[model samples]
Target: MCSFKLRPSKLSRYFCENLKIMQFKNTAEFAKKLDAQDKLASYKDEFIFPVINEKEVIYFTGNSLGLQPKRSQKYVNEIMNDWGGLAVEGHFKAEKPWWDYHERLAAPLAKVVGAKPEEVTVMNTLTVNLHLLMVSFYRPSAKRFKIICEEKAFPSDQYMLASQVRFHGFNPEEAIVEVKKRDGENHWHLEDILKTIEEVGDELALVLIGGVNYYNGQVFDIRTITEAGQKQGAFVGWDLAHAAGNIKLQLHNWGVDFAAWCSYKYMNSGPGNASGIFVNEKYLDRKDIPRFEGWWGTKKETRFLMEPEFEPMPNAEAWQISNAPVLSMAPYLASLSLFDEVNMDLLIEKSKLLTAYLEFVLHEIDVELGETTIFEIITPKDRGCQLSVFLHGQGKALFDYLMKNGVITDWREPNVIRLAPTPFYNSFEEMYRFGQILKQGILEN
Candidate 1:
């Protein structure tokens, strides 16, 4: 059912025509034609779009922050009503009470990551969860102290790993091993990574990587990477901020030791919502892993006994340092309910088609523009939802122009422009409009 037909894209026909007068009519026709055949067209109604200058802007910035669902307001209202009605007793007295709310997010999150229910828990923000995971997993000593990560990871993740190394009484310069692409290589070589693990089998302590890279949109082979790290006696963790809802991940089967991700990107939760964490169920009974404990981490049945002694919960819940933020969680609950309704398998089928169509359309535009075109897609072939395009040298100018025209895609510093066509809410018509805007932006700049 996946079709890769390129019938004159809306943006292409609009701006590149010699007949300036007929362009508008041609574009309108092309847009509607694409929409008529669009498989995921009905999904457009699911999201809230920003209206600019009496027109709805084409939103392509799901990588930065996804649009909120309409149900989020009602979800938050119920939580607010519970707070107003029950006050201190709302933790146990209300419908969808505070006590079990964190657990409510776990099963859906587990399905997203291919984790067991006991292995995944809704917890802190992405970087915060990363640091908390390091507290328990990053057990470095004199011999094995270095952590391996990508050279161009999200700046926050880089900072977290550096600070974590320094906190463990090690210089980041010496303790953090940054795996970069070889000279003249545009992307990382998996063989090189496997070789590095083999070479440093004794000295490596931890392996952390973005599940799907934020800048280049490279979906790393997580299972192979995790196996290589574990073979080197390194604890492997993934920052799944971009990958959590965008791709199908087998976090447990991959033998990933720990992972963390935010909900605001493709997950469609509101900004700064509570994130999820994954701890392999193998660690469920292993008390040797040191954890920073709190009352919430204590056994739930005896938590109210107010004993100073911390008896940690049996599973990933033991990692919880405090009670959750109910307001933030309400948005995730709203978004996650949508996921449960439409399973990841079905969403992934739609995602591949959506992104493939975007790529096909972009490439077709390039071909029409002749040999001087400079846009280069940096994302790998196997990536999910997002495509990172490098505009040779005009990244900023093109990006500014696109923003000026009310097309909202994100630009990484220096070059790349990242556009994510999320499966749940993005439409083929929107992709058509975006491609049209992109062509105009590039031509004008």
Candidate 2:
């Protein structure tokens, strides 16, 4: 029963049309049949899953932290071996010289984020990078000092925005404007966001929102929103923490001023892995722009001279405040290599089908339970790999039961569970199995 107007993208239209006509059966055989036909089926063997009670758990928390790729060990060992043998010399002598190691990720990561190679660079962690990017994009004046964001944003973002406003001697209450969802609604409307931007008009300094809402899995219209913000003479940036590798992005084409995303979630790097950033090509090599400078952000040709003047790199790397964390970046490079092999388009196609199948399975389980639907899929049609479900007439005991039964999911406050079936490793058979387990948990409790 999930239905919404498809976005203008051809992939979205194709996905929506196929989803409407696709029939699903609540059987293991049917699940296996679908998996057998999946073009990305073999990619599942590339990841490592945890086992509990002698069975591999059905992992559905990729939105929180993706499973590790097997190749991550090899990548990590390369760095370790070089450091053990060559020490300081390893900076220049390693197979992938440590000094320029992060440069290898730019091209592939660019493809995933739909940016030019020079516009993207791997850098510090998520919130840290956001703070750094804000140093440049959030320049506020007395007339245009207000920032706009979504209501109920991630806690880290709330803290970051508040601190930024306070640092500039502005009160958070007066400087920050949050666009709220409709009464009793889980998702945001595109028109409401656009209207807010219009109303904010001349006073808006910046518009920064999570491209994909972490809590509800809603995918906002980035291109439209970015244009609206810019029209009002405000800079636009995105926190792509959940959207980076989960959906198709065109930061460059979208004319986004800046963006930052962690690789730990959909990118499948490691826990708190290095973050990647995108700065529009227009901002590159601009000496007039404001940013915090560091040695690593300098041009490589003159970096060895240790000059007194801060000569920034002619690309997004200028935002980097410190030398690359080689250890943390190793796993990220490994994950990006896998991304290069599969490409975002193929993964997205599979994701559409896989997520639709999961939705169908949830509906089947609800039908089996009773006339009153106990499960409400709060996530709207404009979503990526995640579905946030509100469990009506359910409690934490049901979540605990599922966890004990080997279905790993993320539980939110009140009564909600976030399920993300990543295209890389999640299978249709697992989706079918999860539905069975979910039914058992509810009935037993």
Off by over 4 Å in 2: 1-21
What digit string (tens of lDDT, one per residue) describes model 2 on residues 179-290?
9999999999999999999999999999999999999999999999999999999999999999999999999999999999999999999998899999999999989999
TM-score for each of the candidates = 0.91, 0.96
lDDT against the true structure, each candidate: 0.82, 0.92
Which stretches of candidate 1 lie above 4 Å from their native place?
1-40, 393-395
By TM-score, how accurate is candidate 1?
Answer: 0.91
How many collisions per candidate? Answer: 1, 0
Residue 13, model 1: Cα distance from true site in angstroms: 20
| Candidate 2: C-alpha RMSD after superposition | 3.6
Most accurate candidate by lDDT: 2
Candidate 1 lDDT score at position 220: 86
Residue pairs whose backbone atoms clash in candidate 1: 11-436
